[model samples]
Structures are given as structure tokens and as C-alpha cells.
Target: MSITYLEAIREAQAHALRDDPRVFIYGQDVGAFGGAFKATKNLQKEFPGRVLDSPISEDAMVGMAVGAAIEGMRPIIEMQFADFSIVGFNQIVNQAATLFWRTNVPCPITVRLPFGGTEGGGPFHSQSIEAIYAHYPGLVVLTPATVEDAYSMLLEAVAIDDPVIFCEHKFLYYHLKAEKLPSEALPIGKARIAREGRDLTVVAYSAMVHEALVAAEELSAEGWEIEVVDLRSVKPLDTDTVIASVARTGRLLCVGEAWPWGGVTAEVIARVASEGFGLLDVPPQRLNAKDTPVPYHPNLWMAHRPTARAVAAAARKILRR
Candidate 1:
């Protein structure tokens, strides 16, 4: 049976809970309500007290998770929306992120941020905050693009001793599906070449990876070959894999759903230019959401984020250069 990205996440959590007695889920409405997106549907009943609900305070939620981690429990905090994670910024960046480094006590806490733009989600609900958390050290930031990755990576995140920020794209929750969960996956911090080509390289992560693949297909129809690289985890970016792709194509186009200012796209470009400057035949380029608040209207929201059409257009520009 085909499983959706959302279902994969729920299954992963269930698997973690079943396999490890120390692992539990703590989030707002995660108990009876089954989470804001039902990502934890029926988990409370199956796992009982382990899938407990939390108070409305994000800061308190994260703080409690950190304390639980220090005491040897693996706690997963599911932020209702990615944008709201900022409310607990201090606890996440200060306490959880640095606990291992400062005290030598591992904080095995996984913060699940259902991120990325969805129609009518508005500025307050839709935001890609992965880059913000990625800036902090001692935190592993993961962005899973497919259903298989969603299941496998989440399992890995819970198994990891370091603090993890798991950014699961909201847009792919129900839209993307796979025949079965993966038995194994590439290690975290590794990049996947989604499609191979020799003309140009399009590096993307999360929801943008699918868009880049679509753009590659579109370009293929025009007798242009485009390679698409999916950076599975942005924080521990695979610079070697990216540089190798650039070496083959000699052209790069980084795409991201976040705003265009100093985000993942910019980071990828910076790394390529600094570490692989000689590998490129042309300057690396990037495309991102307009530098503005996410819009409320469907049409405006569509225009705000990077789409397949926009990616194709950007690829064409780089291809012609």
C-alpha cells in the first residue's frame, strides 16, 4: 500500500515509541487531538501516557523536553506550525542545543517543525525557519524531501543523541506518497542526486527538491539536461557531493522556499563559490521566495514561493549563460 509523507511520520513515531521505552512524544494537542495535522493520529491511544499532551507555551514545552533529555528520556516536541517555533527560541537555541557541549550530557531531543508554505496558511502559519535553527552549533538540522526519507530520517533523528531540528515540509505531507517505507537510507548530512545530468546542477532541499526535479524534466524536453541534487540535511550540508555535481555540470542553481536573504540558497552558493570556485564555468545562481512575508491569498501564496515554472525559468537562464 502506498503511504503518504504524513503517515510515514506517524509510523516512525510509533516505531520509535514501541522500540524504545525511554522515547515519548510531548506536544500541544498531540494526545487526543492527534496533532494539528493529525500527524500523531491514534498514537495517544496506542502508546497511552507516552504520547502525552503539553501546555500551550512553546518555551515551556522545549524546556521540559530538555530536562527530560538530560534525565535520559528521548522527547519529541511537535511544534503546531514551523512559524510558532520562534516563541521557544531561547530554550531551543540556548538550552537544548548547547547542553551536550556545556555539560557533556547528551540532549537527545527531536523538535518536529511542520514547515513550508501551503495555500492560505498566511505569514503567521507558513514559514521556513530551518536556516534560523541551523545557524546554532551542536544542533542537527534535517530537511526530508520524500516519504521514505520522512520515515527513515525521523527514526534516525530520534536515535541520535544530539539535539535535532526535523523540518518536514507541510506541502508534502499529503501530496507526496511512496509504495513502502525505506528499509535503509543514506546517512544524515549526505546529499542525494535526485536526477543526473551534465548540463547544469540545481541544488535544493525539502519541498524545493520536487520542484527542482520537475524543472529538470521540463528542461529535458527542450534538449537540455539538468541535474537535481537534494540536500537531505541542510545544516550538515554535503559540500563534497555538491562540489562534485558542480564539477560535472560547471553551472549551479540553488533553490529554496525560504526568503532570499542569507538563507539556505545563499549558503549553498557561498560554499560552492568558496570551496569549488574552479569547478564552475559560470557564476552560481539561486532562486528563493520573494523577500516578504508569506501571503494569505492562494494566488499570492503561489507567487510568493518557488514553483516548478519559476524553477524552470531560472534553469533556462543559467543554461543559456
Candidate 2:
């Protein structure tokens, strides 16, 4: 059946609650008011206290989830915004990520962060802070771009015993809609080549995947066939899949809705340059958000982050250069 991005996420949470008695979701506004983005709407009524509303404390809430996970209960902590998760830094990078190696206990904490720009949320709410968690050593990070993956990946995130920070592009929440399999799912860590070509490969995830697809369609009209690779799981990285695609394409364009410097694109570019260096025709290029805070004005915000035209322009130049 056809479902929107937000609906798919809700379905995933509902399905998980129904299937796993140990799995319980709790976060800010997630229980009473549904959620900041309504992702957990009706969950409280559907599962009662299982979908709990916590006081406004990102760090404390995350710590509680970690504690619960270690005690054999699967806790999913949803940070209202991606930037809000920054408040939980020490608990995440130090405690949640290091607990397994520090001792032998499994801390299966899943922190869901809804991210990216929309409605001029200013610097506070709309930050693409994936790099913050991506830099952590023991954390598993995944961002979903499609309806099926959005619904399927949550289950995958909960199944793994490791600490996971799943970044959901909130801007794409209402925009992306598709027919979802009633219950079938997709595996985590396997990057799907959404579109295939030989001239160049565009490796991107989250909202940028939609941008890259639009760019690819425009480029295809002009005779340039670009391959689109979605790095479904970024932490384990699926480097082999990216390298193989670039081996045939000869060029790579890594794009994302975060700052170019230390964002997700930076890691992808580094991997391709390091592992697939000799096979590339030119140095891999990156299309990403500018190295600055998101502005309030619509025109300025449009100019700041990478768009379809920007990605298409970069692809054309990379293909020729």
C-alpha cells in the first residue's frame, strides 16, 4: 500500500511494539502529544505507558535509555530534533558507545534523531549533526531516504545489540511517499544502487538522495548516465559496495545535507579516495551544506545547502574534468 515517510516510521514503531514485548519507545512529547513530528502519534494510546513522555532532558533521557538497554529492556530514545541530541554528547560518545568494550555488557540503545532543514527552524532546531555521532567509534549510524527503508531500518536498528544513532531527515518526512510492502523489510548495511549508470556514481543518503535522483534524471536527459548509491548504513559504511560502483563509473560525487567539512560526505569522500583512489578518473568531489549555520531567509537557505542544480552542475563538471 502507498504510504508517506512519516506513516512508514509510525508503522515501524507500531509493528515493533506489537512484535517485541521488550521493545518500548520513550522520549520528549513522544507519549502524550505523539511527537514533535507526530512520528509517535497514537502510539501512547496504542501501547499505553510503553510510549512514554519524558521531561525535557536529552542527556538524562539518553542515559536512561542506555541503562534500560543494559538491563535487558530495549529502549528507543527519540530526540525531538537533531540538534537537541547535541545535549546528550557525553552520555552517547563516552557511555553508550564505550560500554561494550569497557566491560562486556550489551548496550542496545537506539537514539532516533529527526533532522535537516524545514520552515526556517533557525540554527537551534535544524542542524545536520550526523557528523557528531558518525565520529564516534562504536556507534552504528544509519539514515533512510525512502518509505520502505524508513519503516524497515527501525526494526534493523533495534535488532542490533550495538548503540545506534539513526538520523531521519525530517524535511523529507512529508515530501517522500511510496507504496510499502505490507510487512516485508530491507536489511541494514547494504547500500542500494537506486539508479545505475557507468559515467559517474553519486553516493548520498537521507534528503540528499532525493536531490541526487532529481539531478540524475536531469543529467540523463542530456546524455549523462549517473549511478546513484545510497549508503544505507554509514558507520560500517559498506565501503566495498561504494568502491565497486566507483571502479566501473570512474568518478564519484558524494552529497549530503550537512556541512562539507566534517559532515557525512567527508567520510564518504575519504573512503573513496583512500580505497578507490587508483580506479578514479578524477579526485572525488563533494556537494554539501555550506560551512556555516543555516540562515532564516528562504533564499539564503536555498543558496546555502546543495540542491539538484548544484549536484547536477558538479556531476557535469566532474564527468568532464
Candidate 3:
């Protein structure tokens, strides 16, 4: 039997609750309703009162989690949608993020964000907000691309004595699967080379990692050896690994589902240029979702985000240059 990305996440939470008595899930409809995407499905029944639901207010939910964490509770807050997290931005960036640094009291809260675009999810439901949270100093931002990372990373996030933003891509929940849950995993803040090559390196995370893999395979047929790097975490970004990959490939192309302006892709390019400029044989390039609100139409939605086809085309352009 194959376990999907969503199941891996639920199972990880179950494992955390079983092992750590201080760990509990708190969010809107997370207890009885099992969360908006059913990420916490049947968790309330299994763990009982440990999985309690909160009011509709995102601000209140985060604030309560912060208070709970201050008192030694590891609370996992699930945002119904990535876009909705902005409602609790102040609580996240200022309060939870600064708690440990200001008072030397660790805030061990994990905020689960069901991020990225889906067909017809439109502007309200679809958004990649990793870059926003990653900007802060004290917060650890994670974007899990595969079923294994989805399982392992959550366990690690809950154990850390710091605030964590876990961005689990909605597009991969059901679509990506593995034979079984992983027994071990790469530590957080490490980047994994999904594919190895010499001609170019494609850096990506979340749903965009799959697209980069597809693009790499497509290029392989045309005699272009493309390397694909899966950036497991954004905030504690493994710049050393990224720079080494660029040194080997000598060409860089970053891809992301978020908009082009000031996003993770831009950060990756900036780091490569600043740290490993001499290693790059060609100018580094990147592809991202168009700078527009996610559209309601299926075709427009496809066009709005970076697709496998678009990634491959960008790689071809960079390889040729």
C-alpha cells in the first residue's frame, strides 16, 4: 500500500502526539472537523482533547498557541489556507518569533500552512507565503516536497524549541506517494539533490520540485544533463549545498510557484551570484508564477503558475545561453 503526502503528515502528527505529551494540535475545526483539508482527520478521536478546535479567528488561534507554547505546550496551529495566515501575521512575526530572543523563553509552536495553487482555488485560497515568513529571524520555515520529508520534517518541527512555519503544498497532498513512511530522513536546513548532472542545476521546493524533476527528465532526452535540487527548508536555507551544485553544473535556474518578485527563487539567484559567481559559466536564471492574482479559470490558473513545460523551456533558454 502506498502512503500519500497527506497521510504522511497525519501519521507524523500522530507519532508526535504519541511520543510527546506536551504536543497538541490547535486550530479552527482541527479537532472535530479534522481541519479544512482534513489534514487532522479523525485525529480528535484518536488523541481526544489533545486535538481541540479554536474559533474562526486566525489571530486568536495563533495568540493562544503562543501563550500555550510559553507555558511548555507544543501546539500545532493549522491555517485553513496559506492566504489566511496574513490575519495572524503580527502574532507570528512579532510575538511568537520574538518570544525566545526577547525573554529567553522558547516558543515551540508549529504553524501548518496548506500552501500553493490548486485548480480553481483562485486568489483567496492559493498562495505561497514561505518567503514572507522566512524574512523573520527567529522563525524556521519548511517546505516539504515529498512524502518522506512531509513525515519526517513535521516530527522535527514539533521537537524544536522555536516557532516553525510548515508549508505543505496542497498540490502534492494526494498526488505524491511513497511505498511506506520513512524510518530516517535528512536533517532540516539541508538541500537534497533529486537528480545529478553537470550541464545545469534547477533549484526548487514544494510542488515546484516535481515540475523541476519533470523538466530535468525532458531535457535529458535532448542531451542536456540537468541537476535538480530540492530545498527542504527555506529559512535555514542550505546555501552551501546550493553553491556547490552551481559550481558543478556551472549554470543555475531557480523555479518556484510563488510570484517572481522577492521570492525564494530570487533569493537563491542572489546567493549564487554573491557567493559563487566565479563558478557559474552562464548567467543564473529563474522562473516563477506570473505577477498576478491566481485566476478562477483552470487554463488561467495553469498559466499563472510555473508549469513543467514552462520550466523546461526556461532551462533550454539558459542552457543555450
- Clash count (model 1, backbone only): 0
Q: For candidate 2, what's the RMSD?
A: 1.2
Taking all chains together, each candidate's TM-score versus the true structure is 0.99, 0.97, 0.99
Model 1, C-alpha of 81: deviation from truth (Å): 0.4
Q: In angstroms, give how far residue 84 of model 1 lies from its true place.
A: 0.7
How many clashes in each candidate? 0, 0, 0
Tens-digit lDDT track of model 1 for 80-121: 998989999999999999998999999999999999999989
True lDDT of residue 195, candidate 1: 96
Over 4 Å off, model 3:
none
1-321: candidate 3 lDDT, tens digit per residue: 999999999999999999999999988888888888889999999998899988888998999999999888999999989899999999999999999999999999999999999998999999998998998889999999999999999999999999999999999999999999999999999999999999999999999999999989999999999999999999899999999999898999999999888999999999999999999999999999999988889999998999999999999999998
Two-way TM-score contest, 2 vs 3, winner: 3
Candidate with more favorable, higher lDDT: 2 or 3? 3
The reply for model 2, stretches above 4 Å from the true place, is: none
Q: After superposition, how far is residue 17 of candidate 1 from its true place, in Å?
A: 0.2
Q: What TM-score number comes out for model 1?
A: 0.99
* Collision pairs in model 3: none
